[model samples]
Target: GGKNLNDHALVEVLANEAKNGIEWLKTIDANLSQVGSFGGASVKRIHKPVNDEGKTVAVGSYLVPKLTKAAEDKGVQFVMETAATELVVTDGKVTGVKAGDTTYTGKAVILATGGFAANTEMVLKYKPSYEGFVCTNAPGMTGDGIVMATAIGADTVDMEQIQIHPTVSQETSALITEGLRGDGAILVNSEGKRFFDEVGTRDAVSAAEVAQPGGFAWLIVDNKMVEASSVIAGYIKQGLTVEGADVEALAAAMGVDGAALVETMDKWNACVEAGKDEEFGRTSFANKLDEGPYYAIKVAPGVHHTMGGLKINTNTEVLDASGNVIPGLYAAGEVTGGVHGANRLGGNAVADIIVFGRIAGQQAAAYAN
Candidate 1:
């Protein structure tokens, strides 16, 4: 579906290796159980993991520890709090990295240092219009790898293609998962009316929210949704949710017109029953939000992913400005671009990392041998 929005060759590579990546996770004890739909995806293609209690776990939370433990079991050294400051190039080929005063020389170097979403100076440097937007990235995402690679003549791509997630808690800068919208949650403006298709692409949804009355919207869900999704339940536990006994009460709590909200709820439920969103042309519907104990969370757009970074080939070898591979230098994950062209689809980031990360490791190992 996002073929026109992504690099075709990279999309094919990711598609070809997606299942193998998931299988590798399963080998490392990742308990992926169900497939679900996400925004922009035409079908149920996103694979998610579950915990021992059969509840859905966030993919990053579930996979990181499992992967770390597997690497530890294989005697991989853990380096913490040290940032690589330079890429050591000897005779026109990267041979090692420099962190602080120490130089760790190796036959190959893989850059997995993530993106620059958290680096405000860098973000504004690329996309200046996002001046005051809060970022959802971890603080460590400062583009160290991009800086180092580029300093040593590695080329980059799509440096200005930064992405903002539509539903983010302004107070905590925490991203609300899109699964809520996919599972039938809806967004209402300060007027307590649905404005846009709730499950639209992130950029479109974010732009719509920006054009709303207060530049923010309330994501509404019900107890039934909470019971169905542990991720939503966790947001409630984090105190990000405002609860109400009914629709009118929820409207009052959110400071919107109670009558308008009640009318909106009635119309939305009718649309759900009719299997069509007559108002907004929404094609996805899970269930009606008719249950009691309705919930609302005030959300706005926040910086999420920087879709541009150092350039790399399908083999994961970093490329120079001339489209020639930089010998012994490999990169994967957010540190490299071209996997996503202009806009990235939901659930593809995990696949991008696992697939290209494995490719970088394999290619680097073969180069070393």
Candidate 2:
């Protein structure tokens, strides 16, 4: 729903900024993913010079493997299932988190528990119209960090600016990663017409796709698109996709008109030849749906992740509104604000967690000493 007309332009600027002089990152972290630029919520924006399909390669080759390895090599002493009851602040400096009767004493406790999108009551209290909206996040995210942070003074930004992914399975409402459509999936309505441009940001593309004739649109792809050879196929193997034999059969099952699908495909094939999308203005498409028994899967919007939280300095230190750094306190990951600004790109969240997690850990641990 949020459109950035300058998204592609910004990406180019950031890319140029990197290619020329990027030593700041090298000084901070060596094992970081070598991104040419940042701030694309989807690959289509980042690789504007390439087709939507190539972005999947960018993620699979560059982002995922690097982040996964970095996280494994630098594993935090994670204490899972432990509730952070309250921030133990003494004389206005956060020292630790108190959970149940036990105390987690540290120089700082990074409250990266994520947002309250999972909590219906909290959503209603803060963002009312978004209530009853089902959340796919862990059900335990009941504004605990927000509440706890508020009790001790923490500022949040863009609380109302929550972005929803469009391609959600209507029944289960699981978030279909935007990467699938990035790798050449078309969205079909009940009429079976290709409805939206699949090359936009995840949230915007999802909204456009599902807003067609169907209350739910099936994300259609070919066997070759999500086959074992496809980078997105790995996710399908991980139980993320629903496939069909052909487009007509897919339409029949999803209550889409088969004839409309044939017509839609004809026009789309024409556009694919022209090398430009007429309706959606997508010049960056990777593959055609020419090879398949086509596929269509259900989709809807579910809360992917929150983009707002405690304010932090560039060094990952939590700071108050008055530009005063909170002593004995640090933050990282999704809890730390301002890296991605209003919205975050797909792989960047993982990047933020890893890069800032190290800063928070080292700083917090050192401060503890």
Candidate 3:
């Protein structure tokens, strides 16, 4: 059920740490709930968190506040509006970080700043082919941590392996979650024909969409799916969805061939009812998209994740060009590479950040003590 894309040792470390991470979340009062299968996962192993009202909240949104509150309660001072300009190295060991004119000295430093997907120039420097691609990253994901670490002789890995998510709304640059397709949404081209399996991996689906005539597609879902997923409901509230009362109406609204869409919807509902996708060889099935009042979101590929950053070991210790650990320097999340290898599967990024973020904290603390 697992893709052997990454180093076996790294994957094993992630697998082991993921368990501890989930347990740690529970200890910190994270509201984790049922496990769901995401794209590229054969089993339902991705742990999702729900709010107190039992509404599914995006993992990052749910965890960030909880972790922040927990850390703040423990007297962790959060330095806001300060960007790290450099990493201070004392005798080949990282000792602190410099922000503007201020140097915050410490025994150990953790570079938790995110990836460079939002940095157009940095992204183009690594992968020139991604030019003109809309990024789904926040503006702050400018790889400042990576620049600081590299300036201090730290090495990076997989810098060119940036990931583009398939379902991103160009209008808002908002990432339409993969859960929509997993919950029974279908992607159709301008011709209103299903071109590929909607549940395929991000890279595969993105490529398929790029191959289409307009390099984009429409994700169609019925009211049933909207009711079943709060994520989709939120998308609608964000004005990212184009709604219609029926299949023909939705296709018309999407500027696709209405008759072709009707036929495609008929075939899709049949496949859902029969528990088989004969055309695309899709095995995963959810509720049929036959309910009235369908919604269509115009989506295309957008730069989502940079699968590379500062090279780090299993202990989250950042390494140098000679493959030696930079003592007292640690990194995690999208700032570190080798965890996801080339293509990161959905749900793994969350696991990566939580698992390795905890490890980096512990290792840095240990080094400091």
Candidate 4:
């Protein structure tokens, strides 16, 4: 609604956590590489340093397994395939979790079960308007942590706020990645008009997209942007992209106005030439949309992130409904909310997970000791 930074303190925390995360990754010998950047906010991607047939290599491939082995070496036991159904609380303190008729007691408990974007019922319950909208979260992201924690009176905040990404595929709804726009792709509507700054924040860009003639937009890029970026390669390999010899052909293929597309490109180039985005005030003009063999992908606001869950304080301690810290209960990662406020900027999730997760682990360990 306004230009001021909404979650300024949280943003600072995330930024500092990013530095801590990089140091921790180095300590663990994580096979990380900077893949690309996104938004005028200039967030970068960190992924495994491998070319796995052009597919995105998730952290589970290397990072998670290593961490698991380390934890196992330290006598940490993992209960496989068990769903925690409730928190076992006694005398105002959380003792452990109840899973399918068995209660696993612990000195302290930490919930890292992620957000509820994949649960359609929860989506409908919180955001009824997105009943039929596509979600880009894992199938198991069903708000299990929120349910269990709240069962013990954990207070949840901003439970209704969800983030809609600007560039998810029309066919498979796979995320096209904000890194594409960060690397200099432009968003054009059905009228082939540049509706907003292509590199604007996620919420702003998504809001502009859903308000277009159709409830979607098209990300247009040149051969240079396509070749310089890895995200497009995956999309192209999956047959989710449309290509043309030029802007006219691209617009025709996308069913957009060809002349308008040309004019929009002209104006965008002029903005780049002027070293300023006069139209929408985007700060990053990394590349000019001036190369041909143009490419495009249809995109809409897909449900990507939830900004709400069990509320926690800066110590990563989960709080109760009465604003008191829940004794022996710690939460981190996507399971706890109030870090990103209304809209999470791109790439902040990784920092949030690493930083607060480390904090939560330390606090839990101290509590146990």
Candidate 5:
């Protein structure tokens, strides 16, 4: 993980054949249940990579809409109703789930609803240390899957491994896609020089940003990089930035010292030219910050993900307290732990969704037999 790795960086690392560690994972046999983006499910989005130059926009989301559609078309019968309220089990084998008023029976049930970061009450109950910042997942993510499975007797893991983004925009807590820095975007303080390289894995970048001077920073993007990359366009559409014609103007608008920003930019510009970031080692393969109409967006810490949840085996079966398999039970996506040993890399979550989602779906369907 080099410096400045943002959401896009992680995505590229995964989709790029040479970089993706799990290249063989793309060939695995599996199916999907629910494939739409968790929060915004209705929008018709197709998968097409858009890059302004070699730089791209922050188009990375946990769930890719096109794949989501493909998963649905493949074998996943998306039941986008109310959350599952109860797991009907008899003789220690799960039978079905209670969605709302009606009961839906299945030979096997795969609980892949996601984590409880959005549920503060659940967080306090299981993980108390995360007292600051808003949880990263969509508000609807309330541990429904984990809780339902637990009621049927299942254990969770790495409850403490919550993946906090550590830097969100000041206005909407807007998520500037991790992809931005993957192409060499830089994060500067109010003073403008560099704080982090803005290039490696998401977790690593987040940790560095938080440890900086004020635990506050600015995600600086130049007009060139913005046009070349989807990361900037996505953020702009999301309105993460208060743009400026120059560095000073941006600093003034954000209430940071203009001269300090200028000086920071000077130092950073030198590093960009030299192809080395002494402080953070952001790779020098792409464009440097030499473009005009620079933009700076304010950012601070915010919870982005929770890494702890129901424990399951490779078969995607949720187990009970005594390490006994809860037959007819399965889990995929974020609901299941272990795929992310102790910490999840920047882009692994996406792979987790499709890859494990398929596993859970197939096993659940088979178990249903």
Candidate 6:
């Protein structure tokens, strides 16, 4: 958590790469169209249009498709629906990858298969306490790259440092992006009390929610708050959110104590009116819950990002247990770790892939040539 603070080398690397990634997106018509600022930092997001109930548009959703099309145009082979089972090592060098019974040989290899958050067995093995927690990862994100690399003796760092996002849908576990709260949303517990600052760090908010009666909380917002942001549309369409004409109605819908909910709203509205959240020290009281047509979303902490993986240098070269580079082997993205030491911020993952991914590509190309 303390590892990737302001001006850290890893932060710089991801920031530099993220800049290039944004620039590259422009070449594919996936330009930077909106900036989402949270916790005093900003992230540039690519333009994507989707209806309610649609998946959150990530940069990879646009960038990777364009990159794949471009790569195909250049005669790059495409392998679909296959799993990497092993690393083909020869004379202390990785020569290729073994996916199933077939081996795809190459002069160099770069592993970008993402983290193992979806792998229940691995999750239990690493963090057993998170056995029943929901995950917001694809089923294929089983840490294949980490397994293949480690099979070849690659060293790893921060394997125990996984991130559980503070705001995720209770049923589906989809990320209710921190931007919602950054723009202005308040969280309340079962007793209908504002327990923690809405805009606090992810770890703090998550801990407070887990300490509550049901290990969950409700994010309350008004029509004005909903109108100001596009995220509510998706949540509403997905049936992940509930709406009410007023606080009493909303509380009844959520099965919370109606009187208690009204009292909490009164206190929260007071904070918004006074422009200070003395009760929870919330600095971002952008909107009050006084308007009709209020909404509430049930949220809980769920596994979101893994901050540990194969160790690498600035060049994106994978290292061994003794701090020596593994020739012909490189890694980037979630497969390679140390970028976010304990917890990853919201936008840093995009930055990490962009920065180190390019380095890994360039370095592997140079070595091959």
Model 2: CA > 4 A from native: 1-77, 229-243
lDDT by candidate, in order shown: 0.90, 0.60, 0.87, 0.79, 0.64, 0.79
lDDT of 5 at 170: 45
Cα lDDT tens digits, model 5, 1-369, are 212222333234234432232333333321122111111112211122443344432334422565566567669777775767999997878888998897988677777788777888877765575576665567778878888888878987666666667457745756665545544566776555566656544566667667777777887778887776565776677767777788778777767788987877777778767877787665533466666788767777677776777877766678788878888888876776655644555555666665566667777877676
**TM-score sort, best first:** 1, 3, 6, 4, 5, 2
User: What is the C-alpha lDDT profile of model 4 across 1-52, one tens digit per residue?
Assistant: 2133234555566667777777787766664565655653644453433344
Pairs that collide in candidate 1 are: none
Q: What's the CA RMSD for each of the models?
A: 1.2, 5.7, 1.5, 3.2, 7.4, 3.3
Clashing pairs in 4: none
Candidate 3 has which clashing residue pairs, if any? Answer: none
Model 4, 221: alpha-carbon shift in Å? 2.1
- Regions of model 3 farther than 4 Å from truth: 1-5
Evaluate residue 307 in candidate 5 and report its C-alpha lDDT on the 0 to 100 scale. Answer: 70
- Displacement of residue 296 (Cα, Å) in model 4 is 0.9
Candidate number of the best TM-score: 1
lDDT of 6 by residue, 262-283 (tens): 9988988888799887777776
The worst-scoring run of ten residues by lDDT in candidate 2 lies at: 42-51
Residues forming the 10-long window of minimal summed lDDT in candidate 6: 42-51
Deviation (Å) of 46 in candidate 6: 11
lDDT of the structure predicted as candidate 1: 0.90
Worst 10 residues of 5 by lDDT: 37-46
TM-scores, all candidates, are: 0.97, 0.77, 0.96, 0.87, 0.79, 0.88
Q: What tens-digit string does per-residue lDDT give for candidate 1 at 166-265? A: 9999999999998788878999999999999988888889999999998999999998988877888899999999989999999988999999999999
**199, model 3: CA deviation in Å?**
1.5
**Candidate 3 lDDT, 1-369, residue by residue in tens:** 224546567788888888888888998899567677667766667788765556556887888889999999999999899888988888988898889999999999988899999999999998899999999999999999999889889998888889999999997899988877776789999999999988788899999999999999999999987776677788889999898998888887899888999999999999989999889987778888988899999999999999888988889999999999999999989988888878888888888888889988889989999
